[model samples]
Target: MRLIHLKLAARNVRRQPHRTIALGGAVAFSALVMTLISGFVNGMDSAIQDNVTLYSGGHVLVSGYTVSWSGRLQSRFADEAVANIVQSAYPEIRTASPISQTRATVVFGSREVQLSLRGVDWGKDELYHSSLILSKGDWKSLAAPRTMLMSAQTAARFGLSTGDAVLVRLSTASGQQNVTDYTVAAIYDDGAAGGMSTAFVAFSDLTADLNMKEHEQQAIAIFLKNSTSAENAAQTITKALSEKGYTVSRGAAPTSGALSASSESFVSSVVGSGAAGTAATGTTTGTAAGSSGAGASRRAAAGTVTYYVSTVQELAGEISSALGSIRWIGYAVFALMLIVSATGISNSYRMVLLERTKEIGMLRCIGYKKKDVFSSFIAEGILLAGGAALVGVILGLPVGFGIGLVPFNPHGDFGTALVQGHLKFVPSIGQLALILVFVTIVAVAAVFLPAKKAADVVPVEALRKTA
Candidate 1:
C-alpha cells in the first residue's frame, strides 16, 4: 500500500513538471546554502585548530603566576619533586616540555624592534613546527649558542638575514638591562605570531642571558597519549601539585599582562593611542597616572610563571568556542533557509490539494477512505521533499568541490594581499545525514495540516470544486 501510494505520488508530481521543478529547485537551493555554510563553519573550526595547535600546542597549557612581570611571563613550575609527583599520579602523560618566554629589544645596525622571545626544548616542542614557517635557515640551528630565530617582518625591519649579528637587550627584575649579541640563524614567518617581530631562542641561551640558576621552567606543555584521560590527568596533576604546596592554573586563568605587546599594537591600530593607554592603564581616567604607574611596578614585582596543557579535544573545543559567533550566524542562516524551503513546500502542496479537491472527493465517494487520502497527500509531500533533497545533494557536490577555488584569507585580518595557498573543505557524513533527516522531518510536518484539511473536505462540497 505504501509502495503504491509512493509510486502514485511520484507520477502525480511528474505530471506537473513545472511544480516539481520549482519545489526541487527550492530544496536544491536550500541544501546548497546549508552545505556551503556547514563547509565554511567546519573550515573555520579546522583553521582555528590548526592555528592553536600551531601556536599553543594542543589544548592544555600549565603555568605559574609571578608577582614581578606580565601574565605571560609568569610561569613557575613546582620543583622537580612536584613534577615527579604529578607525573607519577598521571601515568597517561605522553610528552611534556618546559617553556620560558620573555620580551626584549633586538637591534641590528640602525634597526631596532621589540620582540617576544620564547625558549623551549626544540625536540619536545615539535608540534609547533607547522605554525612556524621558516623562510631562511632552520630550527636546528637554534641549538647553537648566540643564535636566534627572527620573524620575517623583524628580519625585514632590521635588514638582517640568517647569519647576521644583532644585539638583544632585556629588562631584568633589578631594573637593570642586560644586553647580548646574537646571530640570526633563522627567519620564521607566521602571521598568527604577528609576523616577524617575534623571535625564538634556545632555553639554555635565555637562561644563560637571564643568569638563572637551577633547571627551573616557567611553563610545561603536556600532551597525553589518550585525550580522554585529560580531565583525570589534570585532576591528578592539580592534586599532586597542591599537595606539594604549588598552585596549578589552567590556560584560561585570568592574570594581568595576558595581553602581549603585539596584541596591544593591534588594539592601538584599531583604536588610537588614547584607547591603547586606556587598555594599558585599565581605566579611562588619565588622572590617576601615579597610581597606574605604581600598579605597573607592583605587577612587575610579582614574578610569575605560566603553564599550558591541552588535549587535542580541548584544543578543538577552544577553537569552536572562539569561532562560536561565526558558527551561530551560519546556523541562523541555515535555519532561515530551511524555514523558507518548508513554507514553499507546504504552500505548493496545499495548492495542489486545493486544485485536485474535486478529484479527491470523487475518489472518496468511490472507495478511498479519508485515511488513505491523508496518507496519499503525505506520501506526495515526502516524495517531493525527497526528490528535492536528492537533487540538492547532487547540486551540492559541485558546489563543495568548487569551494576550494574560492579565495580565502587564512589570516583573519584583510590587510595583506597574499592569497591562502591551500583551501580545505571537509564535509562530515554525519552532518549531512542530520541535514537530510531535518529536511525530511520538516517536510513531513509541513504536509500534516494540509493533508488533514484535504481529508476533512465533504464529498459534495469537494465534488463542486474544479480539478
Candidate 2:
C-alpha cells in the first residue's frame, strides 16, 4: 500500500512539473534558512566554549565572592588540604591547578595598558597551554621572576615583544605600590580575552612580585576525565571542602540542586522557556564555582565551604541566553520565512488538487479508497519535502561556510573591536536531523487538511466537473 501511494504521488508530481518544482522550491528555501540559522548558532556556541576552556580549565572553577577582578583578587581562598580531600574523595579528578589573578598597569617605552595578569602553576595547568596561542617565546620563560607572557594585543600596545623589558606596577594592602621590570617571554593571541591585553606569569613569581600572602588562591581550576563526571565531581569536591571546615562558594559549574534551581528560575524569568531559556540555563551551569573564605572564619567553618561549581554547558547556556535576543531575532525571521514558504506549498497543493479533480474522482470510482487518496497526497508532500531538504543540505554548505568566513566581533558583542579573522562554519549532525524532521512535519501538516478535503470530494460531483 505504501509503495502504491508513493508511485501515485511521484506520478502525480511528474504530471505537473512546474507545480512540483514550486513545492520543492518552497521546502528547499525554508530548509536553507533554518540550516543557516542553526549553523550560526552552533558555530557561535562552539567558539564560546573553546574560549572558556582556554581561559578556565575544562572542569571546575573554585572562587570566592568579591574576588571579581576578572578572577584576579581574592577575598576567599581554597586550602590545599581541601583540594587534597576532594582529590581523594573522587578519583575522577585528572589535575588540580591553583591560580591567582590581579589587575596591573604594564608599561614599556611610554606605552601603557591595564592588564589582567594570571598567575598559574605552569607545570601543572594544561589550561594555560590550551588557552593561549603563542606567537613567540615560550611558557617556560614565565618561570623566572620578572618575566611575563603578554598577549599579542598587549605586546603591540606596549610596543614590546619577547626579550623586551616592560614595567609592571601593582597595588598592595598597605596603601603601597610595588614596581617591577619584567622581560616579555611570550606573545599570545586569544581573540577578545587575550587580544584585549592580558598577560600570564608564574604563580610563584607573581606572588613574590606582589607580596601575596600564603594559602590565598583566587581560584582553583580543576580538570576532569569527562563532562559526565564533571557535575558529580564538583559536588563531591564541594562537599569534602565543606566537611573539612572551609567556607565554599560555587562558581561557573554549580552542582548543588539549590543553586541550579535558583539559576534556572532566574533565567526562566528573564528569557522564558524558549531557545533563550536553554542557552541561559546552559551558561549558568558551565561556569559554577565554589569559594572558601580566608582567615579565622575559614578555619571555624572547617569541613564546610561555600563553593560554586558550574558545568561547561551552563556557561554556554548563560552566554546563549545573554545573546538570546540576537538568536531570537534570527529565529523569528526564519520562522516568518518558513510560514510564508509553507503557505506557498499549501497553495500549490490546493491548485494541483483542483486540477486533478477528475483523476481523483476516477480513482474513487475505480474502488480506490478515500484513505488511499489522502495517503497519496500526504506521500507527495513528504517526497517534495525530502527533495527540498536534500537540496538545502547541498546548497547550505557553501552559504553557511561563506557566512562563517565573514569576520565579526570575536568578543561576540557589537561594541567591542572586530575580530580580524574568518570563522569556519561547522554544522552539527543533530541540528541537520532536527531541521529535516521539522520541515517534514510542517509539510505533512500543511498537506493534511487539504488531503482530507480532497478525500471528502463526492465521486459523482468530481466526475461531473468539466475540465
Candidate 3:
C-alpha cells in the first residue's frame, strides 16, 4: 500500500535479473499455451457450426417419425403445416427448410456410388443458394424437374460430366425398388466437411418418385437469426406444438436412426394406411383394434405424426462429445503448466527470502510491520506474473495469425473438415484477460510461504548472524 514498500520490491526484483527471467519465462509460456489452445478451439467450433448450418441442418431441426408395431423407424412426414406454424409464430426464425431424403445408388455407365438423395425446395431454400460454391454448371438449372446436383468428389469418382444422365435406384416407402433417371445439373464442392456425399434433386421430382403427396417432407430445419438462442427456441417451439394437439418427443431423438416409442404409444401404423395395413405389417388383430395401443395405431393410420425436435448441439452428437473431450484435455494441460510456473515462483522467492534476511531485519528496526513485508513480496510476484502474461498474450496474436496463414487441403482428409481450407485461430480478448489474472493469482499464492518466513525474521538474530 505504501510507495516505500513498492519501491523496495521493484529494486529487489531488478537485482536478480536471471532469476526473474526464469520465473517469468515459465509464466509466459503457460499464458502463451492457454491463448493458442483457446483460439484453436474457438476456430474449430465456428467452422463446424457453419458447416452444419449450411450443409446438414439448421440450428434447430424438427424431424417426423412413424413407428410400426414391428418397431421399424420410417422417415415419413407431412411437415409443411408444422413448418408454417413455427415460421409464423417465431420472429427469431430465419428460414425453415422442409427436406426429404432417401438412401440411393447413382449409376453412370458401369461406375456407381451409393449416397443419400436429398430433396430440396429450390424455390424456398436460401441457405444452400448462398453458401454452396459450385465448381461447374449453373445453380438455376436445379429448378428443372428430373435434374440433380452431386458433389465434385462424386462426379470425379463417377467420371461423369455435367449434362450426363444418371439412373438413381432407391427403395420406396412401401419397400419396393424404384429407378429414375436424372441429368446432372451442377456439381458443388463440399470441401469434405464431414458427412456422406449427398446428391440433391428437385423437391417435387424426388417426392413424386418416392410416392409422397403435396406438402410432405421428412423434416423441417429451423434456422435462427442467432445460433446461440437455439436451445430456448427449441423449448418454445416444442411447447407450442404440444399445445396444438401434436405429439412431441420428450428428448432428442437418436441421431443414428434408432428412435424409441412415441410419447403416447409403442404401436403405430404408417400414414395413409388403415388398420388392415397394420395387420399386414404383422400386428395382431387384437393389437390393432383393442386398447390404447390399438387406438394409437388407428390414429397413426389416420395421419397422426410424432415430432422430434433437436438443437444442432444434439444433432452433432459425436462431434460435440469429441470437442468436450478436447476441452477437458486442454484444461488438464493448462493446470500442469500453471503448476510448473507456481513451482518456479516458490523456489525463486525462497532464495530471495534467504538473501534478504538482514535487509528485512533493517526494515523491521525502521518500524516496518510483518504485513508490509508480506505485501511487498506479494506485489513483486504479481508484477512478475502480470507483465509476463501480458507479453505472452501480445506475442500469441501474431503467432496464431501466422499459423492460420499456412493453407491446407480441406477436402483431402477428415482432419481438414475441422477447418475451412486452412488453420483458424480466433483469439478472444476476454480469454486472454482471464489467463493473466489467473497466472498472477497463482504466482502470489506460490510465494505465500516464503514471504511469511521472510516477515518472521527477528531483527537481533538477523543482525547478529551478519555481524
- The best candidate by TM-score is 3
Q: Give a tens-digit lDDT track for model 1, residues 267-286.
A: 23422333212221122211
Output the TM-score of candidate 2: 0.79
Candidate 2 per-residue lDDT over residues 1-467, each given as its tens digit: 47999999988778878877877887787778777877766665555555555555556776542222232222334355645665686787777777766678887877777868777788897766755667888777767776787877667656776898888898642225889877888887746441345577877777766565666555677777665576687788767766654444455523222223354344233323332112211222122233443311111111122345555555555565755665687778767866776887788778878988888999999998999999999999888888788798679978988776676655445212223344546688887887788788888888888899899988889989844
- Candidate 2, run of 10 with poorest lDDT: 295-304
Better of 1 and 3 by TM-score: 3
Q: Which of the predicted structures, 2 or 3, would earn the higher lDDT when compared with the native?
A: 3
Per-model lDDT: 0.63, 0.65, 0.75
lDDT of 3 by residue, 1-467 (tens): 78877787788889989988988888888888888888877786777676766555578888776554444456666545677677776789988878777889999999888998988888777767866777889887887889998888899998877899999999865456899999999988756443336798987888888877776677887888888888888888888776665666644553323334452244243223343322212222222353454334332432335677888766656666777787788878988999988988999889888788888899889888999998889888888888899888888889988888876766654343355466679988898889999988998899899999988889889888876
Error of 1 at 447 (Å): 1.6
Question: What TM-score should be assigned to candidate 1?
Answer: 0.77
* Superposition-based RMSD of candidate 1 using all C-alpha atoms, in angstroms: 8.8
Candidate of highest lDDT:
3
Q: State the displacement of the C-alpha of residue 112, model 1, in Å, after optimal TM-score superposition.
A: 3.1
